[model samples]
Target chain A: MSLPNPSFAPIDWERATPATLLERIAEAKIVGMGGAGFPTAEKISLTRKHPPNIVIANGMETDPDVNADRVLLEQHLNEVLTGLRIVARILSAVHSYVVTSHKKTIQVAQGCLNDNETVRYLKPTFQNGAERELIQILTGHVVKDNRFPAFDGYLVLNVHTLFAVAEAIAGKPLTKRLVTVHDETRWIDIATPVESILESSDPIRVGCYATGHRPRVNEVLTATVNAISTDKSVHALPCIHCGWCDEACPRDVPVESLFVMAEQLKPNLDAQDALNRCNDCGACVVACPSNIHLLDHVRALRQRNDIEWERISRATQARLRVDAREQRMRSDVIRSDTKRTERMQQQHKWQ
Target chain B: MAVTDRPKFQTTGIMVHVVIALLPGLGVGAWFLGHKVFLVVLVSILAAVATEAIGTRSVQTLRDGTAVVTGMLIGLCLPPSVAIWVPFVASVSAIALGKLVFGGLGKNLFNPAMVGYALVLIAFPMQLVYLDGLTGATALDVLKHQETESLQQLINHPAFGLVGAKHFEWMNLAFLVGGLYLVLLRIVPWLLPLSVLLGIAVPALVFLPLYDATYSFGSPWFHLFAGGTMLTAFFIATDPVTSPSAKLPQIIYGFFVGSVAFFIRCFGTWADGFVFAILLANAFLPLLEPKKVALDN
Candidate 1:
């Protein structure tokens, strides 16, 4: 496929400082575009202190149904490469890689890569697209227990996100993105209502079916939406306890039990842990024969945990406030007693 | 809405496949046992669906297809000559008491079919016996009754078929084919059914050699193909709701079910102990599923 002509002018890298570029990115309000929606400027600022050793342009669209990243790389290879160079230069990275599982995207990206940039092919798996998993695969170094890649000097940005960065730098102001709507990848502008794009009468999903959220009818498109689907509704059946969800979980979460707990609305501490570990990749949902929406259950459990945590924290704060008042009253009583004793002693001395 | 979110299969679809897989066994039973089997199946299904609808106060529950499955299973377990009302009562009780009272479908602790069969087995034992006016001592019953007969003599008995039991072996083979279809379709896990078969066969193998002139308990093939063994292994005992969900637990549960049924057949009063054996294994499901209690909490 012929590469799309770069709509935005090339960044004047020699004249522009990292701070000015970051400010312009912030002004453009460019987010991660990798479904996380984290602001690009904040991510770049976080890695500024660490001085990144490597920058990875993540094009591993592991969801079998999502092709936004692959299409973006195939159509706008130079723009994505230019974005990667700009980010790498800002981070002062020595090495840079464009990671993808798509053969066509890899071939086209390889042809576009400069001397410093290399194309890394990773076999498409559900978890391999995750920030931490991609970093671990590219660099044998683990991100080290609950820490993010940006904190560890590894700047892993999604290919679509970099394309957005390139656009933002060229003064496009992050208005449009390549979204896969019903398996067909196309450019969709932000703030375009979901109703306009979907022709189907089915309920709208904001992302790929596996990990997508059901959006309100009037909700507008956002930068992070990589895919949209008007899939038919699945009539959920009772779980047959097949343990397929457990087998499909990338994080070894007890998905079956978690589903049970979520259904019963009695999530425990372990269920909370499972919910935390769930990356919302929807692998369990895909593997389920009964068509149980397992990811929805996990999200519900997380929401419940949040509410429970908030309640406990509020109670804790109230108790702390009451304890402080009681301590103050006790101190006042001691002070009054001391004053009374001192006045009596003075009166006795005067006598 | 996008098409990628759609599930590839539905629960109703799985039930439809299960019904399709069961056709071979149903066909064999109708051929050997007569048209009355179909009548029994129809009555049982109607009664089950009606009971579930009444109990849940929702006609929509019928669409899930579980009631039909439960009814069909109870019907399959009954003798061909059983009174038509027997299936109706058994199916109603299976849905109402065995399933609905315990919270319907996935929540039921015991296999509904086994519960229904066990209830009728206790309530109307006389009606269950004497299929077509022949003393309904299934081949296992005949083998159990043999005191001084050698293995060769037992094999030669009129109750014995070419390899296993007369008429019953073919029925078992039919059920085996149906069961295998379910396994290959991934509707039912292979581990549970295989373990259940192994559960019965291994004990019979170990004890078959001990069967000399005076104490012939039948061979592994006889036990495997004998009355209700294949049916219970595939249809009744392997019920996903009652059986253990995980692999290791499923294996142990299957073994427990098989061994118990074999022991009951040998020493107990029942001709085929599969019903009671499956119910017993169902009771142990909580122990096997250690996460169940934690998940409930």
Candidate 2:
């Protein structure tokens, strides 16, 4: 299960201080490779403020179609572990864990684990891939209800992000990443034009098919891109009202009603709550018998909600400005009237 | 990395499955009622498709196959002895007035088949007479007309079969099989059919024992197996467009339809009241569906 050659030259651990490591990560501009794209340096710094108790390397690829993390774990086990140790050292974390469900991935990771490091296996599911959910699984603490894992003295980094961190420490800028395109996992350079990878005229999805966006043709691969795919058009049909989407949703979000609301463009407040709760995991789409692109509807509804929010905010700002101006003008007029009356009174007393 | 949509099931596939499940019932209906049932079904289907295509000005909707389903359902509800033109008119009305007028397909509030059936029932009552006048009474008609006869005597009547009304019981059995297949496929929700049966059976069970020689009512088995009970409960009443989609609402809606239909059959004047019962439930769908209620508030 281990990689054939773990001959990666060891990082100069004795010479590299936490400050220097943080500086290098910030300079490389490495962000979360888990697709959130939050800067790794900032996340480390935030966790360092509280001196995290644990650092978890998230290798759980819950998206059934995406295998970039699994492949990275298999191919670059040493580099991923080095990155995990580096983060642990910088955050002054007491214990570090590599979280994965894949047996081979865990075995490879276990061969390279240090004294403070442990391998934790979690059964892969869509919810387990989420940072909050992963923290809950590993620590038995629900961070999602109130605060983030980092706020609770835990730092969770994606395995791919740790790989990028290792490369950044080895003096490579954040550039190339493993991306699964057309079911083949390969190292794709960042900023590679999507058109170069897309071989067909099919719609280009910028991530896994389930949660990926239909990227414009001119878009380029980025540090966060885990998978790219050409759209295989599902022969979609009208909804049969089967309610499988409702059953499949992890958050119990009432996806069937959300679909109807999204289609009709008449989403209510309850639908808004469903939209917020949706993680866009695409499980509902997978469960749908009609092949409805349910995530697309969810995204569309969210975008519409965002636009509506923006409009209301803009209108409120404009009204506030007008009211402030009107008050100022009224004050100015009253001052002028008082001065005129005082001057007339003075003239009358002199006469 | 194969970027196909997650779920591979197509809406057309569901419709195709539903149509396949219905074949057994159609076959039974044809055997008992003769080839005219097929003719009526064919005419209704063609008329419905034509109305949808011409009214909506879109031929692509035919691929979805809902029009075909609506047409077939309307045709099945018709009396085998009904004039061919009656189904044609009903099919056209079912698609145009019942469906298209409500903005077509998923937008419609009423079950198109039930709407068309109710329209034709009111307009052509005399022409809707069944079985070539051989029995002169359907099971519901017999139950409604019963006076000074015991339940046993009613069962021994010429219109009555061992299980239910003559020839109708076999058709009902075929439909029950088809409906179960639909439920197994998960195309139709099980709650609707189960609740509908309970809705009818519970009431009939409580009422049948009260039957005296002066007021004869059919047994629960006879009611369940009788004319249009299985067909309406499984096929017509469970139409997604008209029926409530959420679990609790769907159960309540099914129960309401079944109970009202039974009440109409036992005490009301209609020979079979499924059409009216379904229509009445359809009217309550917005109130029953949790989503619609949330939206209104």
Candidate 3:
């Protein structure tokens, strides 16, 4: 289906059914461009049943250092556009938006758009690209208190993700990604596979927290890789809640509250309202005054609690369904017996 | 056996409770400072931990939460405009000079956070004031520099007798709220802030009639609010290492801090007095050791 002025840069396009979107994602091996190495196809397959109405291209490179999106827009605008169009088409989105900061980048992207009617630009704010926060601002729709962008009819993608989507349509697999390595002193450019990038470079001396893992040539670049070490030993101490993290959080989630809630013996839903909405951005870890491993703890608690709670809920629901089925069968059996008894009595009277 | 066994208090649990008790003040600080504050805090704390690890030449991660506490206190003391590197520097100083030099955490006599703050203060006094202040109004600037003099002349300045006194008063109120939270939570015993307040106040009261009676005892409150007074009360003076462990010694330590703080505020060339007083008190901490109880009596 032709979308009204779809924003894809004019390279190529592929029409994918929900099934095709998943199949192509896996075949292309497209990975999450927002630093996570998760296979894009896996994410697409999981969320395909629930189509997103609004699509966001997250450009808020709040890292203060990394500027790949800015660079991509500056140079590869058309290529990125073609990918965005494909996503919008597949998702059946009403509106597609680009979230970015660099003025020059937005200008360049806009210029390349050739006045595509469906796409608009969102000025970059701190944490502006966080999927949930971006969705809230763009669509004014918040997902279920504990849910994510998928719940709000919004699908948020990074500039890199769009680039990957375009490549996938072109039948190119995701084999490499752009990694910005810089510190108080130097910036280096290297193109290595997702697993090899960490192994190729030395750990940076500063801003390790932002990097998420320590720079070591031997370490594997995991899904949640940061330039710094995330080991408990290297992780900063617990939060003293100086409000720095909450204030610094560009997404404006209560990171400290999430930490406190995770520590509570009995999880109080009201108390943990903050964690339920957390976007898992490492910004809070950066802001914590006590250098609390805030994101780590919050994410761990969220994952653990989410899994346990979901299991219990599913089990309960299954049990109820089984019991209801049994009761209905018993009622049916009694009714059948009553009919048989009447039939036998009528036969005897006739005789 | 006679029922003469004394109950064993859970010291570890008590310490944890003390750390836990600090959360409310922390929450209030976070509420005001926002997420950026957390970033500064985390960086400073990580920097502090790294510094201690590197300084001691050990791979061991410092636990006791002392370095973290120090980094946080320093972060709170610092103005938001402070470069990220400044916190890194302060954290290092707090852990290295303030804590590790004497030993780690509880063994140190001087508050590590103040040491870090003092280091930054020395290195970047200009940066310590928020960007808003350089562009707008800061409480101390109004009081010390006569920023509100034009308005004062118009109203006769009766409320505060000074042009910016009213504004400074509110800033002081914010600090007081921060300070009270610390005290109420028992993060730092009241003796430190109370004694420091008294130390500064009693002298101001005694000298007010002789020096400048118009400013009077209220000048002490102004002094408390003007610069880092409240911050120091909640953060610095309460440094576990720098202050005596014994209650009476802590009171005496606070008294000295008050007196010296008053002296610096009254006679020193600078407007702020916490650092000089803290450093002076740190020197006296050894003399007030618990083992020296016989000498004191």
Candidate 4:
């Protein structure tokens, strides 16, 4: 499909405040198309609060099977670059980057970069594609646990989102996206029923086959849905503890231990580290020799962890309540004893 | 982290590679040991496959090819001189007891082949010995029995060749070459076999100077190439399902297996103590596993 030519309007960069730009982006309804469908406007707003922010146009498709990003970059390089600069202008950032793993995408982006902009190719791996890992790789700054990359002045947005941002500036709505149907790429409308995309009842995952999930009943295409894979089987063998999952984990989670914990459907304090570190990238799933869905196990353990945490919190609250009551009673008894001693002293003096 | 680097292998594919790698060593063994070695190996393979089929009651389970590999390993571990029934019994136990009892394949704690071999060796110690009409004492036997012979004189014995046992050294060399192929293909990690060798060598070297040359416990070279040392290092102890998988744990496990095996060969009556050492190491696997390795980077 051809690129949309919506109603065009010239940009007035001088008048574009960060708030106005965020509003436009919010109106566009853009999100992180390459990864989790987080609201792009809120992400930009978060990064904007931290000045001297660095904007990264994420042109790299981390999924090994999906090359939709490369095609998007090749087809709509202008709009993507414009969208990146719009974010940079919105943040008044120090610099901007256009990072992709594809050689062709790098070449396409490199020519249009300004003096403040840089484009480079990073070797494609699951870890490098992740947000925190990508930030660490590019900037050598580790995003701490429970912290967002925005705290470090890093704004990462997918190229598709940028395309929408530019279109939003030109007065257009985000109605269609590039969906990888089987092997071919097509412009699929937002909220299109997943069943209509592929007629086969054969099992299908809603994302990249390597790391995606089965579509929920009547699930439709959203910004996060990148690929439709139809060849997966629901059946999986028992985990052999081969340690391939451990080797394949980008987050350095001890997946084998987690798998053991998951097998019992109970959360163990022993595997708490693994449960915290795992982001469910599905790298372990791809690496498993037994065709086991290791992510499902990790997810199961995480749910158990949540329940365990709830019980622990309740117990801790009960313990604190008892401790507080004991302290109060002790203080009250001491105060009463001091009053009684004062009364005795008064009586002795009178005698 | 790059899943795309190596491609096109599953349980079936890996077992097939293992079987292919065993060919050179199996060929060398039959060439030196006798035609009966092939008979023994074939009987073991048949028994293991049949047992696996019966245990699971599904032909699809046989497609995994683990039963064949288990049979081959049991056959190789046994002496060719044993009766045909011995091979059958070992193969059955290797599949049914060693593997199937513990839920088969990856679930078993001990090396399947060693479980069967160790059981039969304990039960029928006399039957497990190698006794050709040409020479009764194997290389390890010569080391233990020749009290009057000095180290120099022992080298000239008919059982001894160059730096190792006459027929066994060739088989060991064949197994070593095949093992290197597995390592090169990245089918098996190199740390496992290398650490195992280092484990045995360090102890052998340390004890060499302590003992009198007249009553030497064989040189490090002889220890490496003698008995089932090479086979154990490469094939048996390196089994991923049974052995420790993490780097630090694997090194410790390999070293422990090697040192114990060496100590048993030198002090105990058994000609080769690898089976016991491996099972013992397998027992300690959980303790050796690294608790957690947080990514520093």
Q: What global local distance difference test value does model 2 have? A: 0.82
Predicted candidate 4 versus true structure: per-residue lDDT over B25-107, tens digit per residue:
99999889888889988999999999999998887778778889999999999989998899898889888889899887677
**Tens digits of per-residue lDDT for model 1, B124-155:** 99878636744345677687787437989888
Which residue runs of candidate 1 sit more than 4 Å off their true CA positions?
Answer: A1-10, A14-20, A114-116, A120-123, A231-234, A331-351, B1-8, B53-59, B133-136, B209-213, B290-297
For every candidate structure, what is the RMSD over all alpha carbons to the true structure, in angstroms?
4.2, 4.6, 18.1, 4.3
- Candidate 4 at A72: error in angstroms? 1.9
Segments in model 2 whose C-alpha atoms lie over 4 Å from true places: A1-10, A13-15, A101-124, A144-146, A171-174, A232-243, A254-272, A328-351, B1-8, B56-58, B132-136, B161-163, B290-297
| Docking verdict class for candidate 3 | incorrect
TM-score of 3: 0.46
User: For residues A1-351, could you state the per-residue lDDT of candidate 3 as single tens digits?
Assistant: 234333322333453454555456566556666765666665554444576466677766655345556666666667677777777777666677876766776666665553332344555444565666677777787776566556546677777778777876766554444444332212122232233333333323212344343344544433222232223324344333234455556555765555555665334345345665565555655444344667656766676677767887999999999999999999999999999999999999999
Candidate 4, position B289, lDDT? 67
Q: Write the per-residue lDDT of candidate 1 for residues A192-240, one digit (tens) a residue.
A: 9976887777777778777878888578998888888864335667677
User: Using DockQ as the measure, which candidate wins?
Assistant: 1
Candidate 4 chain A weakest lDDT stretch, 10 residues: A5-14
Ranking by TM-score: 4, 1, 2, 3
